[model samples]
Target: MTSGKAALLIAALGLSACQSVSQFADPLAPDIVREAGLGEQILNSGDPNGAVRYFERAAAATPDDVAMQRSLAIANMRAGDLRAAERAMDAVLASDAATPQDRVERGFIAVRLDDWERAGAMTAALPPDLDTARRALLEALVADRARDWSAADAAYARALAGAENKAAALNNWGVSRLARGDASAAIATFERALATDPKLFAAKNNLAIARAMRGDYALPDGVESDRERAVLQHNMALVAQRKGDAAEARRLLERAIAAHPQHYRAAVEQLAALEN
Candidate 1:
C-alpha cells in the first residue's frame, strides 16, 4: 500500500498531467515525483533534516524546476543551513516565477545571515499590504539587532497590533526590555504574555529568567509540559542560591532533574556544584 505522502504525490502528479495514469504525461519521472512528495511530507511533519535529504535529491534531479528549488530552500532554512537556503532563494528570485512568499522568506534568510543591507532591500521590494504582522516582527528583530531602539519599539507595536498570536510579540518585547536593562518592565511583559497564552513556553521561560534576574523565586502557573516545569524548578533553584539557601537550592535542583531527565542538564550541573 502506498503511504499517504506517496498517494498525495500521485494525485498531484495526475492533476498536473490533467488525466489519469494510463494517459498521463508527467513532466517529472516517477522516482523524482515520489521523492519530492516524500520531501514535502517530511517538511510538513516538521522533520526538516529528513526533508532536506529528500529535497536535495529531487532538486538535483530537477535543477530547473522552480518549485523544487523553492522547496529545497525552505527545507534548508528549517534545517538551519542558512547559506544553502540563501543560495537556493537567490536562484528562485532570479527566476521569473518567484512569488511574494518567496521574497518574504528570502528576506528572513538575509536577516538570519546578518546581511542587513540585503534584508532591507528585500523588505523594501515586498508588496506593502502583504503579511503586515510578520513583516513588522522581522523588521523589529532587525532593528533590535542594530540597536535602533526607537525603530524596534515602533515595529514591535505594529507587530502586536496586527498579530494573531500576541504571545510571541509580547515575549519578544519582554526580551527587548530585558536587553535594555528594564527588568521590571520585562517581568510585567512576560506576565502579560503568559496571560495571553498559557501554553507559550518561550514566555514562561522568559518569565523564569526575569524572576531569577531579580532574585525572586516563584513557580510559573499554567505550564503543561514536564520540560517546562523542570525549567521553572531550575529557575527556582537559582533563586534559592541567590537567597543563600544552599540546601533548598539543592533540593529544588534535584526535583527539577527528576521532573524531566531529558531537559535538566543545567539543574544537574548546578546540583553538582552545590554538592562540591
Candidate 2:
C-alpha cells in the first residue's frame, strides 16, 4: 500500500481528535482538570506537541490522577511519540481507579504497539455490557491483525449492530477488507460508509485508495477542510506513484505537504524519499 493509504488506515483505527477528557469519569483536582482541558483544546487545534507540554504539566502535578495520565497518553500518541504514550497508558492502567474507557485505551495503545497478546487480553477482559460497540470494534481489529477474516467479519457485524456511528464501523470494515487484498469488497464497503455519512472524509479517502488499487484514476469527491483536502491529494499521489507516474506523484505530494505543513507527515516523508 502507498504511504498515504497506510497513514489513512492508521488514522482510521487510531485515537481520533474528537476524543475529550470529559469521556473519563475519574474525579480530578480542579487545577489538573483545567490544565488537561487546555491540553485537549490544543490537541483538537492540531498541535499535539503543544498539547503534550500542557498535559505533561498536569500529569506531573497530579501523579496519581488517571484522567491527567490519559490526556497525556492521547496527546503523546497524537504527537507520534508511541513510547511516551505507552508509558502514560501503563500508568493509567496501573491505577486502582482506572475506568473501563481507560482499559479500552490501553488496549488501543497495545494494538498500536503491535503487542497483540496484550491487546487481545485487555480487550477480551472488557465488560461485555459496557461500550459494546467499541468492544466489538476492538475485537474486530484484533481479529484482523491475526488475519482471521471470518472472525473479523463476525466482530465487525456485531460492531455495526451496536455502533452509534455506523459510518466509522463501515470504514474500518472496508480497511480490513483492503488489508486482506479484497479491493472490490473494500470499495463497496467504503461506498456504503459514505452513503451512511457523506461527511466521513476518511471513508472518502479510503474509497479513493480502493479505486486506485484497482487501477482507477478517478478521485473521490467531497467538501473538506484544507488538511483533509491535502490528505486526499496525498492519496491521489500514492495512486500516481503506483501507476509509475513519478513526476505527477512528486507534484501532488509536494502540494499536499505545502497545503498542510502541520499535518501530513507521511506526505512530507514520501516527498523526501522521492527527492532522495
Candidate 3:
C-alpha cells in the first residue's frame, strides 16, 4: 500500500488505542448520580455513543468531579472522540483528587493523540516511585512512537511483567514489530497476545495482516463487510507486491475490485499502476 493507504488501514484497524475502565457501580452523589450511573450502564452495554449524553450531563452537573470526568473521558475515548476525551481528562487531572492512574491515563490519551511531548510530561508528572503496569504501558507507547525499538521492547516487558491483562500491551508491541518490518516477530507476538486473551479481536486481525505480509493472504472470519473485505484484499495486494509477487498482487487487487460494493478506485488505480 501507499503510505497514505497504510496509515488509513492501521487507523481503521483500531489497534493504536487501548485502555481499561473499572466496572461501574452506584455513586453516593445526589445530583449527578443518576446521570453518571446511566452513562456507565450504557457504556458497559457497548454503546459508547449512547453513553456520551448521560456522561455529558453528569459532568455538567458536577464540573470538577474527578470520577465523573474520568468516566466521561473513558466514554469519549471508547467512542473514538479523542478530542473530547482529552478535554475530559484535562478536567480530571486538574482536580485535586486525581490519582497516579489518572496521570497514566492522561499520558495514554496523549500517546493516542500523537502528542509525544505531553505524553512524556504526563509520565513525568506521576510520582517518581510509582510503578504500575499502566505506567509501563504508557512508556512503551511513547517509545514506540519515537521509534526507539529497544526502549519500547523494554517498556513492554516491564508492562507485562506481572500484569494480568497482558493482551493489550502485547498487541501494541506486535503493532510496533509490524511497523519495524518484522513480520515474523509480529506474528509470534500477536499469537502470544491472542493466547493471553482469546477475545482480543485486534490481535486476530493483526495476525492475518502478519500472515499476509509473508504472502499467505487470507481474510479473517471477523471481516464481514464488503468494504472491509475490499480493504483487506487491497492491503494484501500491496503486501504481495512488496514481497515481489506481482502476479499475486494483481490477483488480489482483482479480487478487491470484485468484492467492493461500488467502484473501488484505490484498487483500480493500483492495478493500473501495476500494469504500467
TM-score for every candidate vs. truth? Answer: 0.71, 0.67, 0.72
TM-score of model number 1 = 0.71
Clashing pairs in 1: none
180-247, model 1: which lDDT tens digit per residue?
A: 66778878988998898888776787677667556666667887878877877877676557557788
- Better by TM-score, candidate 3 or 1: 3
- The predictions' CA RMSDs to the true structure, in order, are 15.4, 7.4, 6.9
Cα lDDT listed for each candidate:
0.69, 0.71, 0.70
What clash count goes with each model? 0, 0, 0
Q: What lDDT is reached at residue 85 by model 2?
A: 83
Error of 1 at 184 (Å): 3.0
Query: Alpha carbon lDDT of residue 188, candidate 2?
Result: 95
Indicate the worst ten consecutive residues by lDDT in candidate 3.
21-30
Query: Model 3 segments beyond 4 Å from truth?
Result: 1-40, 218-231, 241-245, 256-276
Q: Rank the candidates by TM-score, best first.
A: 3, 1, 2
Best by TM-score: 3
lDDT of 2 by residue, 47-114 (tens): 77888998899889988777888888877876778779889978887889776666666666677677
lDDT of 1 at 234: 78
